[model samples]
Target chain A: MESEKAKILPFYVLIDVSASMSGDKLDQANRIMPQVVDALAEAPILADKVRFCVIDFGSDAQVRLPLCDVLDQHSSLPSLTIRGATSYAAAFRLLRSEIEVNVKQLKADGYLVHRPAVFFISDGEPTDPEHEWRTAFQDLTAGFPTYPNFVPCGVDSANPRTLATLIHPASGPKQMQMYLMEKGQNPADAIAAIAEILISSMLASGQSMAQGSSGMILPAKQDLPAGISAHSSDDFV
Target chain B: MAAPEEGPVRPVPEGKWQGYVEPFVVGDPGRAAAGVVPLPDESAWDRKDTVLDAFALREGRARIVEVRAASVRGLAHRAYGKVRQDEYGFRRTANGRYLVVCVADGVSSGELSHKAAMIAAKGGARWLAGLLDRTEPADLPWGQFIRGVAVMIERNGRKLLRGRDDLDAEKCDVREVAQRLATTVLYAVIDLHAVDGTHAVHVVTVGDTSAWVLREGGRWEPQEAVKNDGAEVFSPTVHALPLPPATEPVPVRTTVRAGEALVLMTDGIGDPLGQGTGPVGRFLADVWERPPASGLEFAGQIGFARKSFDDDRTVVAVWPVNGR
Candidate 1:
């Protein structure tokens, strides 16, 4: 008999590819994806535990990079291109279905799947009606077995209250975190910070597993980039 | 000198039992092949532990049981140049009526947790041994015993902090100091007295350190369910030592017949064992049907390489010696 399947942590990076993110912001986004992937590639032990995925959302949402073993793939992530509009509803709906399908497939493959973590980076609020996006967000979160740890990172022109609302587990100990750029801080720098957050969180979370703990460990508040401020949903409450 | 005359070679029997098969590595060896570069501790006065510590043999037929134990640095720790955070110890009462064994894994976040593991395994085992000598097993107050050990850890931890020149020990918050030296423990006591030729073993555990009974003919039976089996989301949150208020050790009681062995280990070995049906468990079950010829061999068996299961591995096995 062989050993039981090793545990895995699935991480989804959702980049808003709307018109608002056109120009320098989109370039920064494209540049960071490869850097983040390369960072994980360098640390094979941490890479072994992480399953990386890239999702792009505009007027519609699509799986730009399917959930995969970043270490095994050894392929470059697709560059994000500007698309229709910022549709939070599309992102959440697609995320819900993707998580449901991905977690099921991972389980079938004999890997012990951990709760998925979705890092949502946006420069603007949802283009759809408040109720429509909220319904989609609720579907992505509430009463779902494989619901994700939603980390919403809001940059230039992005509404803090809206990003706060996007946080899953709105009022619990395991509540999701929100990050925003400080006033006048360059959005490109914020993108770099997001890259840092993504890589650090992946390493920290993987290290936790290596240490025999299975929790998703975020980087400390002090470790956040200078231009970025972290908050829980409570600030909005 | 004249050579002796050569004799005719006899054909070996088909399907006959062969000699010992050494434990082999599986999957990626990772950075373990690069070898170790010792990591320096922040406090220079505090020296790091040896990377590997395995007794060739620590067997004693005290009353009815024979004990064998070993502790080894994990490949991940070795690759990272970190000291082995796992420790194990065994003690026998003066009257030789009982034997106590302890295994502890220092929580990784705590820099000084390696010392905590040492205290828990060695200090805790010694304390438990004395307690057994004074009190009857049935009358033992387990909750009080655990709390007493917690107090012992705090006292020893304070002494460790005070020894450091960098920090003011008295100014440090007591709770934070305790947290910095957290470790999980599993303690087992074998009742030397035999009831119908079977010895009773009492096990108390906090966190994920576990115990199993390996029966004759290669059957591995986990004493209790510690890992969450078949759960979609596995939380690594463990309840470690210097435990919260009202925390009680998870207790398990079982009998070990002669030829059967009771084994205690940390999650480094338990996570890989998973319900004792995997390759790791199968290998262990096959190799440990009888006590290893030496503790070096026992440590080798405990440190078998399996993919993605690298963590500090420590084990203490108590086998009941027949007719002892």
Candidate 2:
């Protein structure tokens, strides 16, 4: 009975809420976010180890949803408001601080915290030209056990180079790496599909960590639109 | 009264659907007892021997106890058949000179891993027993022994294929054959020759499956383990025998105090206890405080609902009683 206490794997989704991602992108993000939580709720075994959160970024980013235990998280995600510009630094800053607070609360409640995973989605370039995102990203990847598996997913016009930086190669080899979604015929439908795949990967990675895996084992990649591709930094570089 | 299959029997299982092996079912919440039932004996259709229950033996100075079981998902996932891919073996020589213990885990993705897992668990113990029967005791080259086990797995796999006619009758895919039987090896030997209440042990391991000696000082380090700083993020880091990219095993030897205990387990138990995946900050104090138990009663202890667990769990915990 002593081993019955659950292990918590906090998963956060960072969705770009800038003007560029307003119509089809925002609709898909809003629609597909609930499915991620539902997938966890459906599988009790997987649900036991996972906690969910959502961060929406533009001129600023804030937690659209708090860290909700997968088993106890019944409500759907709150609709994200359209913000001014794509601010990569704002997203990273919100994520790092929110994770620190979430993880602390989880441990205080007697939960064993697995490494966190951040699933980020964006459609445009960073508005913060000061390269301030790099500083905040460094703080996110800093030492002392709050490092998260940063998996950035690119959609319609999102710069692959900036998306690549989200993976933080200097940190070391990562589990949930990065992916580029296809600019398919329908942007809304394509974004929704990519969201589904990302959520599935998050569930699989969380389950693997609980089972003593190396913390970032991704689910097998299903055949995707020919336009999509994958990239991973060797040794987290 | 079916005795152990005598002589050099065909290593390959009789036809997949032809044999009278006990059938296993997926986990059912409505069921009152454990879905797992041990085979009656090592015979056709008997459930007693197949059940991975607890087994224990006490020698002059040390006591060894082990429990092995199928993963909760593997037990519940009714894809083809519910079979366990974890195996373990223990043997003490007649002269009481050495005690050998080993554990192995078949890759979940492997096709014929249940059979291969049994081979791995016993292969090391068998080698040490046979060597003792022929040669005199001396400082064993621990590296040579692990490397030998890896080579033996590759050879015996071919021999088993040769023993069966089905392979010759219909060509089986060669790559699939190796992939289907992949498994991890953690082999160990402990000297019974205790002088002034201490015993020397040699351990060699491949992959993430681990072994640790719990010192009486409330500290623990893996037996023969190089420090893994958590830099490697790959999931399947196992150095399986005879598989591609064969990496050589490194062995380490250490002397243990009388009150110390040894823990050998597959990733199922190792990861959570050691917190390899993340920081197990809470309830660290409440983990495994009581002394070990005797029978299948230990099975209940392992079956508890740990958050980050649910694989084929196998553990061998040894305590040297006389040394204390």
lDDT measured at residue A118 in model 1 versus the true structure, 0 to 100? 86
Winning model by lDDT: 1
Give the alpha carbon lDDT tens digit for every residue of A1-237 in model 2: 122223566788888899988877788889766787667555555565567788899999988888886445374567987999988898988888898888776665545566777778888788897569888888888673677888887888887777777774324445456677655545666677677667667656644543335365554555444445667654233
DockQ in order:
0.35, 0.12
Q: Write down the TM-score of every candidate.
A: 0.81, 0.64
- lDDT minimum window of 10 residues, candidate 2 chain B: B24-33
Give Cα-based local distance difference scores for all models: 0.77, 0.60
DockQ, candidate 2, vs. native dimer = 0.12
Tens digit of per-residue lDDT, candidate 2, span B199-297: 777777766667777666445556654323333122345666546335555566776655566667776566555532223213221232223342343
| Candidate 1 lDDT over residue span B67-132, tens digit each | 667787776565455668888888888887888889999887677778888888998899889888
Q: Which CAPRI quality tier does the interface of model 1 achieve?
A: acceptable
Instruction: TM-score chain B for all models.
Output: 0.82, 0.67
